[model samples]
Target: MKTCNNCGAQVEDVAKFCPECGFKFGSIAEPRAVVTDMYDHTSEFSPEDIANNKLYAILMYCVSLMGIIIGLLAAGDSPYVRFHIKQSLKLFICEVILGLITGALFWTVIVGIVGGIAIVVLAVVDIICLVNACKGLAKEPPIVCKIGFLK
Candidate 1:
């Protein structure tokens, strides 16, 4: 028997994923390279660029469209800030569209529930993007990455 690291549950040694949390184990488990790749964008910008513009990048996520404008004016030359601004822009647009849809369909209970959940998810993604900016990384946010308008 072995303990699953993810959920702290006991499992058979031969099992590939934890029964309690579905966490992959051993050789089949998620690879370090893939995990690193998911957040790796340091090579795209210089260290100085990341350091200088990280604050403006973070602001873009915190203040929505207004933050994007601030970031553009403050750190327009920084590739690092620009990257985060694009991610923030994508999220802002999605939020606007979701809000409009939910408002129009406010009469339906199902739309209200689903829209509320989606809004929560977008908020979480915004936090993720803000954290990435704080870390000086340019990782594209999940779900919002699929938006093709701003790229």
Candidate 2:
């Protein structure tokens, strides 16, 4: 078995992506071809793989924004898990920015409504992500896969 670089999980040699991390098996230390055409973005997740990592995927959504760290340090043993975690990571960044904005808004009680709205919006987003993860879907929100900076 080959070890996955992202989650350090052992994977079969014939696998392309890590069963836990979704990262290309052999390219652990190497950067991924993140900019490949959408048509070429094939990381077929088998039902067995999805079944194996479902819990990790759900944890990625339920653990607040820290789920991203959990994904990096622990989960991410499957492509489906990695996809959701990456999306959650991007959302966490947005959450941080929104939090800073919300903190500023708190000074003005009237305008602080925006903070509440942001909270609600993030919660809804989180729920949606959680559902998808539970389904073992590797489908990503637009921005998650679009950001090619991540190797």
Highest lDDT model number: 1
RMSD in order of candidates: 10.8, 15.3
lDDT of 1 by residue, 1-151 (tens): 9988778899998998888998889744545564556545767789999888888988898899999999899888878888887788889989999999999997899999999999999999999888888888888888878665777
Give the per-residue lDDT of model 2 (tens digit) for 1-151: 7777788898887889876768875555557767755622225777887787777778878995566667666755667667666677776776777788888778787657888786777778778767877766665544434555342
In terms of TM-score, which candidate is strongest?
Answer: 1
Candidate 1 has a TM-score of: 0.73
Error of 1 at 132 (Å): 1.1
lDDT of each: 0.85, 0.69
Candidate 2 Cα lDDT to native: 0.69
TM-score of every candidate: 0.73, 0.57
List the pairs of residues colliding in candidate 1: none
Among all windows of 10 consecutive residues in model 1, the one with the lowest summed lDDT is 27-36
